[model samples]
Target: MMTKSDDEFLDDIFGTAKAQPTLVPDDLMARVMADAQSALVKPDGAPKQSLFAGVFDIIGGWPSVGGLAMAGVAGLWFGVSPPAALSTWTAELIGVPVSVDLFGDTTAYFAETQIDG
Candidate 1:
């Protein structure tokens, strides 16, 4: 069997044929444009949000609101009942004796110190 060159094999397979162009019908193009125009048109009298609602939307909705509420509550709790270390530090700074009980009432201790001093 004789071996054929690469160009000879390709030319034999393709035979210099040009592909035919495809055209979309005018009716189909018109329908597509009409659908696109309808989609692009805005509805009449769209509902407007209040300033607060717009701000909430900018901050990413309900999860962000819940997170902000939780942060506020945490801040309030920490402000009312500070950590043990902070209390100890404050007591030392004020020349007051530190209490032995970790969860003891700090107000009672301060009252006793004030009475004794």
Candidate 2:
């Protein structure tokens, strides 16, 4: 059970009073308005970026570009001719027969399927 002192302490911290607006000094308010107006104004000119720099920024920085290049090369390599291990893994995953030289047969899985013969 909560004590009365604890209840009073909680009420003091989270009082039911509404928030009241505080008045700002005229000089400080004027300075704040001036700063806001200055921030809204656009600069006259910015330095031009080269085509390569602009393209680089658009596709993210050097790290992202390097990753993309590596991914592209890997994709091309896999598309042209995948390695034997990858083929074996995919074949096992898909439960399909792979024509790898020594250890690619799925004869063991024949028991799992209901073949009439």
Top candidate (lDDT): 1
TM-score, structure 1 vs. true: 0.42
**Ten-residue stretch with the least lDDT total in model 2:** 13-22
lDDT of 2 by residue, 31-83 (tens): 99999987874566556789999899998989999999999999999989999
lDDT of 2: 0.82
On TM-score, the leading prediction is 1
TM-score each candidate. Answer: 0.42, 0.37
Error of 2 at 78 (Å): 1.1
lDDT of 1 by residue, 29-116 (tens): 9999999987884666567789999999999999999999999999898799999997788878897865576757988989999999
Error of 2 at 65 (Å): 0.7
